[model samples]
Target chain A: MGKSIESILKKYDNCSRDSLISLLQEIQENEGFLSEEAIVKTGKKLKIPTSKIYGVATFYNQFRFEPTGKYHVMVCRGTACHVLGSLTVLQELEKVLKIKAGQTTRDGLFSIEVVACMGACGLAPVININGSFYANVTAESIKEIIESYRKKEE
Target chain B: MSIQIEVNGKKLEAFEGETILTALKRNGIRVPTLCHMNDFIPSGACRLCVVEIVGNPRLVSSCSFPVSDGMKILTNSPRVIESRKTIIELLLSNHPDDCLYCIRNNNCELQSLAKEYHVIERRIHGNKNSFKLDHSSTSIVRDPEKCILCGRCVRVCEETIGVSAIEYINRGSKTLIGTTMQKGLNTSSCVNCGQCIMVCPTGALTEKNQTHMVQDALQQKDKTLVVQYAPSISVSIAEEFGMAPGTDINGLLNAALRKMGFKYVFDTTFGADLTIMEEASELIQRITEGKTLPMFTSCCPAWVKYIEEFAPDFIDNLSTCKSPQQMTGAVIKSYFAEQSNLKPEDIISVSIMPCTAKKFEMQRETMGRNGVKDVDIAITTRELIELIHLHGIDMKTIQPEITDSPMGVRSSAGKIFGATGGVMEAALRTAYKKITGEELVDFKINAVRGFEGRKEAKIKINDDLEVGVAVISGLGNVRALLDEIRNGKNDVHFIEVMTCPGGCVAGGGQRIGVDRSFIEARTKSLYDIDDRETIKVSHKNPEIIELYDNYFGHPLSHKSHELLHTCYMERDVLL
Candidate 1:
């Protein structure tokens, strides 16, 4: 893991701090999460402070501090989604999962978070349950969607 | 003179010196084209407008090809379509196909043209351009992946607004639209006016929206959501509701606020009038005290931000009077809260502005008072339209009603605050009267009015006092005037500068669907409103004048100066 992290950082040796963040984001997307050993190796290879590497990882919403669940639920909170009652859909998810936004369920079946404008104004309340878009969602529909995810996890 | 042009064996009549594309368009001929904006010089990079000329072996771009007498043009031959299709296919090869998830998805001209041409799939997806999003400024966002490198935004920034904050960085396929030194937009010489966002054909440039935060505030029971509209918004919001341009929807707007669950629906124009009272008094004090001569109006946040970032030397010349939107925010947080017996934190002040820079202006440290930010949220007229649509409000059928009293009652001087030279004219109306101790029999001061890039006039006060006034819109125009002043050619006693081209009426955050004629018509309506109003002078505004005499000390008093007159800081070093 450390060797892989060092190689990844070496690939972007000439990149700026912003570029490093982008590179780390891409790496995290592929690996699911950044381990402590991977972060130390990245810092050492990139010639940046470990604290600085952690700071960049924590700054953006796209960067996750912890490992995500097998199933990730992203509910859009953009203007269009809000208008179409995306918050209600989010609320239903919280109630069912017994967790807040950005928190995975106790059973590790779901992880939920809100995103800004997903570019769907007319079709609001867009739910990305397991990387698949479920547009024009309602509270009832959200429940049905989550049930499918739960059954898959089981 | 009529020029004969042959189009694929068909004779067509065109003017002597029109571009082939324009001549073709005038004759009801459709040609596949892009990168040819109506407002700026044509950059024939798209190559979709390539036409076969009779005498020329190679096809020429119709947009850049000038029509000559008896020139033969073939716009839509099989060969031309194939070339155009291939050009479009190459454009789509690296372009993102997630239109439903793009901000300008439906409204994008590029997307519409793509669908029209049926170039749905890309043959090549190798080595796609990967661009990280830049959300540095409060007014504008840059998603480089969406940018087609049309250079329209860059041209508009340089040619129109005269703020060349954005330019092409790197070279070729790696070329990206960014600040000169890759600085954060706020740190760059960006005025935060958002004119670049207006001309962008895709979702590459957009206003940083706080609509979700506003929605959250609206849902909170403890929070009192109060909204105020700038002078320009009343004249233009009607266009968003599909009403005729310049339709006065003040009543409907007020009624809509009630329907939208707003605790208070107020007008920023009242604060505009208040600004006149304060600014006029400050001008008089500056003249008498012989302190800062030729004071610049600071109402336009874009101009204020520009002066703060680039021209810090002229900070002393900036009139301390807070912008009307900020004035409304300050008043709502302090005076209005005291009157209503509500905590400052309970009141969520939102301004519906014609400008985007106001979003950044509201976040400045000087805007807040008593540990609470003066304004909680700032949404543009466009965002307000979206909010109205979300609530299913039938704006067309709703009858117009009056804005709330005291904070809503505005004079003609306040109404014209939307247009160029309006603030200067308003201040002059009150300043001349206050200085001479007589009414301005001729209320209309045409000296500062008009659409000229910059205008200057000398008004002789009581035959002994000559005060020079200048009005400038567009940051580039302001830069020229300021340069002249800096060179010791300072003849003007007062200067009013608005960052937008035509002023707030043609602001960066107004409705996008309206045509130039409609915007002009709406501007005319704003002027008409001022003309029709009985109260023509800012000093004559009973509410503001009463407030000055009672709670607040008289205008120019130390207390009034402290509360109303705020100073600008130099942001040059920070930048």
Candidate 2:
């Protein structure tokens, strides 16, 4: 993890501070979360303050400052998703997980977020858990998908 | 000869060798398009009119691509729909989604096409590129982010006006339409005609609005909001209220303005007559003194702005007289203020004009000779309709009423100021009498009147005095005339130039979504107004002559020149 952060910092060493968010996003996509060393090194390399870097990391919903759960659920709140009761499906998942959106259970098995329109207009309520699409979801379908993920985690 | 073209598996007979797009349109098949103009050659940059042609292997741009014999065109096929959807998706990806907030949200062709194509989301993940807004010019704005890079505006500027001021700068994703050398429109050779704004499909090019300022004035109880209407506005503004083109709604317009909470509703024609008096006197003075020969009319703001930017050498030739609209503002602030017993600063003067350039013209430093900006805010004819609608004034229900006394009334010479060659005709009507001291037999100068690009006439001002007059409409025609003058090929004693194609009636800030029939109707209505007016000649306008002699001494007098005329400034800022 330390070596990976060092390589990410090296890749974005010459990038300007204005493009730090885009660079950090690219780094987070590979490393999953921004480590302390990665944040400090990014600040040093981009000539940005460490506090400012950490502030930006926490500001955007896409940036994960800490370690994420084993299963990452992104429920689309796009125009299509909202029209097809995606909010209700999200509520069901939160109730079952004993946590809210963008939170994981005490066991650290799940994390979720609502994203913008994902270009699936006809296929509404598209939920992606661990990079797999589950379209036209209801409360029951969401429960089933979360149960399968929980079983796999176990 | 008929050409067989198959659309959606149905065979239709089209004109032999006509564009596939035109053929489809003729057969009641509507394919989305943005850059296709009936007047110009097809550019086919929009890619909305893409049709899947069998045996051709690839999608063809129907606008530019001609219909071959036995052309199998599959429009709205699954492949074609998918291709169109992809194009729309790409457009939507970078386009700003603030539809409700946008000025042209409902009127925009792009928004309508997006809704028709069912483009709900952007699948591609690309960073949104930000660009700065350009509001340097008073007439038009350049919002780069809203620009789709369809090249319609660029083509219209080059093909229609022949002013290649705006062009595509840079390349790839960073490409933008701008003036050469990235100069502000004021510094560039842009004529401020606003043909580019008229052709733009999106909210990329728009008129600078002073609606908020008018709204503020309306709310102020202490300030009296006095509004004046330009001659061209009455002819075209009816279209905004859904009335038939060329519907003479001057009476209805007066009633509507009164209903909109205006204290005094005046006519700009009165000021136009005043303009004729001053301009004709200036021309005669220049000719007699042999200084600044071939004096140009300074009525059109776009023409004035064009001269200020491109041809600074011809500044001396421009008549040192304010436009009728500006003259009305100055008169209202000073002359009308004293007559009505009101403070010039307290009386808020607003002008309704069929011009976007008038908004910029009012802001010029020289326009504040009346101790304040002559015109506080200038709203386009379309914006006046918007205000009327906002105030719940139904134009159809409003009873026809005549304009108020004095400034509200105007002569036939003032009424004709809306059309091409109007200024030259108006000036000649007065200048001939001033030179020969006799009323001419022919009231209408047939030579200077018409839709021709450039017109010239040699009228005998009595037996000894023969004055050569040239009338140029549209900025492109003006450029040619100026080139001829520079090359010493063209020599005329008097000249008139209107930046718009058909003068103020077809101005940039006129009503949108109009057909050719509507334009004809509006033009006929304008002429009808001129024919019906009792006072035909500018010299016979009793109110204007009374105002000049009783208040300001006479035309071309030191006070009249100081208050009603202004010099041009050589602008260097880029648009």
lDDT of each: 0.80, 0.80
Q: Which stretches of candidate 2 lie over 4 Å from their true place?
A: A1-154, B1-18, B22-29, B52-54, B68-78, B120-126, B162-165, B179-191, B573-575
DockQ of each: 0.02, 0.01
lDDT minimum window of 10 residues, candidate 1 chain B: B179-188
Per-residue lDDT of candidate 2, residues B1-575 (tens digit) = 88777877888999887899999998999888888887679988888899988887889989999987777888888999999888878887888778898888788988898888887766865556687787777778888888999998777666666555577755577667766334456555566677787778889888887787788888899987898999887888666677777887889989988887888999998899999999999988987898977789999887887787667899999999999988999888888888888999898999999888888788889997646888999988868877887889988777998887668768888888988888888788888888888876777887987778789999888776788989987777787788788888545989988877778888888876666676667767767766676677898988887887778899988888778999998764322
Model 1 over residues B293-379: C-alpha lDDT tens digits?
A: 889999998898778866788999999888999888888877788888899999988999988999989998888866798788999
* TM of each candidate vs. truth: 0.76, 0.74
DockQ of 1: 0.02
TM-score of the second chain, each candidate in turn, equals 0.94, 0.92
- Candidate 2 similarity to native, TM-score: 0.74
